[model samples]
Target: MAAYRVPHRPEVEARARRQTQIARWVGLALIWLLVGVLIFLGERAIPDQHLPWTPLSVVDPIGAATKAKAARTGEDVAACRGVLAKGGLTYVLAEDSANGFCSVRDAIQITGGMAPLLPADAAMTCKQALAVAIWERQIVQPAAFEAFGHAVVGIEHYGAYSCRRIYGQQAGPPSEHASANALDVAGFRLANGEVVWVKSDWDDPGLRGRFLRQVREGACRVFITTLSPDYNAAHADHLHLDMGGKPLCA
Candidate 1:
């Protein structure tokens, strides 16, 4: 018997399913490409900028004196324009003060315009001129001479100004460094080609001791307070020199 039968187009149905699958993969690939392009452009369209640093404040009389000196001379306590001319440096001293620690200047003098004493135009109340004298005779000359077998070629420094508390003390005042009243020296090179760095030679116990002693002895003659690696780790990398009123050494 002849009977009407439903058409079974299985191949057609399978083909349709395959086309749907292909379309989905193509759509996904396009979406991924667009996402990658957007990411690349976003990264290139942005700009960068730098942050600013803050200034330090005065801690003790020495620091106050440094700022005062800077104000008075219209130059910083570590100003080296005049000294630099003689030694070939524009800024021999970097930082000149701290906020919570005490400091003292060295005593000693050499040239007139650049006497060991505070610069003539410094706005400090310190009346002692011997600090510069000590610095010249002991710290500056001896370090350079001993390390090099001749005179010192140059002085390397960390900084002088820092508006913070003393390394150990909880709170006294600000450090003299904060006021630009302190000078932190790192090392010195002698004309004979020797180097006296605080970080390297501060603990040799002999040469380092000799250098520290010389500088400390020099500091006694100049600044009111002197701190060195022998004093503590805080000063292990440099000689802290502060000259404002009296004198003390560590």
Candidate 2:
């Protein structure tokens, strides 16, 4: 009672193997195609701000892609200015200037719209200005209202441009201020005429402290760097926000 068996043919086995391989390839191709179609459809359903591939608009609500999109503006001055204009930010291009390692090019002095940046003449790179606009509209104002039920009227800043190294050191890399790429926010003025100082209100257990911390957290989302009182003594009095160097939040 020997069982019947088919003779093993190397050619037939090889053909079967090739067919299996082909089937696998077809399956993978179909899977990839389906994935791509889903992504395309999803992009249409989602907001442009959330999609990394879409052109960035400063007016767009802050989303997962905002920081990445904002970062790209640093590379293109015209594009950054365009974003500011499209967002309805009133700004004038600053005269280009250079001083040794410090140079201000493609910089702008934002004059109106949103909260007024203190020190009426302060100027910063177009990219930094764009970040400030987005931050004020999307983060600062909203957080202010949510916390104190009052909108922010003005942003009090230490300054924007300075020809100096990091912490004014004689050596090492230049600070973002050297190129007007940073702002030291000292406090905020509310529509109610009350002011919230990072130096004083940061430790309060009330709305002011919450608002300040919330804005700082949100700044970390848009700016490449955010140093608060928690960072070190140098930043204890103001929130140091910048678009230079690596991403850091403290």
Candidate 3:
């Protein structure tokens, strides 16, 4: 007599598949949770202003995380575009990719935003441009009204995307500007038609000083890196903001 075998059950197989999927999702969640923890510990944005990053964890224990990040970055840029449209912001989209040294593709040339602020012509990654829009909307305008009783009507910037090594050094890593990932703001024009230069007003210890400090700190919520006159002599004349994902908020 031949040995009898149990037949496969379709319902049981379906249950097993469901369990497998649940387990896979749980594992992914755990992996991202660990990354989130590391990000929280590593990020040092201003108090109450730490940015919620785009889940850009570099560790890919499963080896597929990189692909997932690429997909997410695309989604992030799309979301930024939506925000720009809804806010009535004005900008021109840029081509993707600068070079191996510059990761910015899908950049933008921002021409307008809250209070008519504009960036010098340069390819600013969609993420960086959106971050600036958010900063202006949520932080700069409100702070100006509160601190100065006037709205910020204009802003001045050195530029964004200089393609140089950090601090113009012949050696060392490329600066954030190399990839169009940073902006250097030099000053602002207020509703009262007063110009506040970062160099002159940074030490005012008055409403102008407080307003500058507030915006600088507020930028930490959007830009992962915010360097001001307080950071170093190189940044003494401007507030340097970048999406380098560093925990820097100087």
Candidate 4:
């Protein structure tokens, strides 16, 4: 066996080298192609500083509020900001307050868009703010369009971030409003200056009543609690929305 060894051909070695070179080039091309694909997808994720994707469609300048919300540990607040920005709604971040048993954490005072100044200016927690923003965009705006052929211009409300106990319950537990986690919406002003009050419209069998009920039901998607005139006497004049405890829709 030792004496039978044969020398390799020069052409065979040359052919092998050429094949190896081609394989290497092919691998490099594939890597470059993948890199190009990734860059394209990254660009598409946010086009012209806007997110046109579901849920995130309302966020302009993607990841804009990610760090800010993370700092306050308010995922809902951050999301609301994105929605507001995307919708071209402007707002100002308000000062947070901690006063004895009452505090408004991660609060913001909405400055523009939707019910800007109805009854009063209210401070809201991140969760409450997000719930209201979503309710406005997904429910109120669309319903308003269908009913009045005009957009909603303002909102009336009982208030948000009240430092008080639950209404009607004289004793035990504090209300969600104690921490700015709830808001009471009284009515909405249309683009035509028509005001729809919950007290009057909640009982109507027309579009106004139907729109109110539609929004109340839609609020259940973002708010953990939604109460309407049908709930009880105390809530007969407004829609009570909150984000705390168990999920409830009345």
Candidate 5:
């Protein structure tokens, strides 16, 4: 018998090539799966301490300057207008909270970004107005009008919105003040022509202590965080106000 011969057919060769291609595809899929698993494991192994949330860098020099300017001019404007009417001044009338700059201007216009409560007509929020009214009737007005015989002056405040974090807090949630949810006050003025500045009075044992006590007491009914001169050097110039969650004074 002649030796049996096995002949290669084109169809058979094509089928073999297709099988090879399928195997390669399978291998690639497995590799991808392995990579995905490894990545998941690596993420699980990292510690939260090594990947903490960090606050954004400073970028609002103009805002800072504006705040300073506002603090200086806010009181003067209020005096000129008398009783600090809200819907009167051009800046107050044109304030569009949608625009960040305009909000700051409004803050400066009404409260100096840190002064006592404004008149109800010039208030940004009910809490703010209430606080100011209370302070004026119980503290500012009494001290200036009846006690000291002053004009019972109004207050100035820092704007209500910012896109930044609390000072010295590099890793945490967004600041309440940054979202139009908070306020930073620079100081207050008495109608007796007395200006009790935060930066200046923050460290004075007598004036600073009294101011902090009064503000803190008032803030309990308004802001969440009533940071004052006692909180830190940064707060030495203003009383931080937040109308968010529960009251937190520190």
Candidate 6:
């Protein structure tokens, strides 16, 4: 009665240790399940355009997934045209042509959307047109209003489809223009009868300069390449925006 103690059992201690580890694993499993459910719900709550897996619609708001979705349109001509139609744009498919390294296929002439393109017949790839439409709606118009308190009435572009190499070089890689994959935006015409020329107003200390810079920055977000006056003398007279070749923003 004075000394009564139970001896420690190795088997019992081992069993207890195993049970603790099992409980820890079970808790971890529960935590992971809860986290997965939360992520699923979050994705469901977001818009389709914001979700990377959804089909792209040109009318969709510009979001993190917008650029990637737009880029994918280049892979399918029909899909790109479908996006344009769904966005309520007026466009006509241009006749397909091929000549040496200069070929234009799956290209379109956008007649109605935000503003008319000057020269009335500037044609570009469907993917390029889609990007232009989105840029005008999301970036250009908003920047125009913020800067000039007027809406853009027309877009003045140098050209879209040109059969020439980069800088018209006699020998080198072909330019985006060769396939109608690029747009040279020379300026914009505002509702107030005012014209903003990149060559003339690019350095203006007033609203014109601000508007141009803002649109250029937005173009960098939407297009794979955005070259402005700041890039080089070659692009000093227009903003060279394209969805071809390497990515660049200068």
- The sequence of per-residue lDDT tens digits that candidate 2 reaches over residues 1-250 is 9999999899999999999999999999999999999899989899998988888887788899898899896579888878888888888878999999999988889987789988778899887888889999999988998998999998999999999999999999999999999999999999999999999999999898999999999999899999999999999899998998689999
- Each candidate's TM vs. the true structure? 0.45, 0.88, 0.67, 0.67, 0.45, 0.84
TM-score of 2: 0.88
Please provide, for model 1 over 1-250, each residue's C-alpha lDDT reduced to its tens digit, 9 standing for 90 to 100: 9999989999999999999999999999999999989766754653211101112111111222332332232233333233223332112222233223443232122234221222222212122222333255435675656644576555566655455556636676666654555666777666565667888886676865576567766565446677887778777887777654235578
Q: Flag clash pairs in model 6.
A: none
Decide which is better by lDDT, 1 or 3. 3
lDDT of 4 by residue, 61-108 (tens): 224332233223335666667666666666777788877667877777
Residue-level lDDT of model 3, residues 193-246, one tens digit each, is 898889999999888889899999877655678999998988889999877747
lDDT of 5 by residue, 122-209 (tens): 3343233323333434444444344335543545456555655555366666565544445566655665567667677655667445
Q: Model 3: runs farther than 4 Å from truth?
A: 1-75, 95-104, 118-122
Candidate with better lDDT, 1 vs 5: 1
Cα deviation in Å at residue 242, candidate 6? Answer: 0.5
Q: Could you tell me how far off, in angstroms, the CA of residue 41 lies in candidate 2 after the best superposition? A: 2.6
Worst 10 residues of 1 by lDDT: 48-57
lDDT of each: 0.50, 0.90, 0.73, 0.73, 0.48, 0.90
lDDT of 3 at 97: 64
TM-score of 4: 0.67
Q: Model 3 Cα displacement at 84 (Å)?
A: 1.9
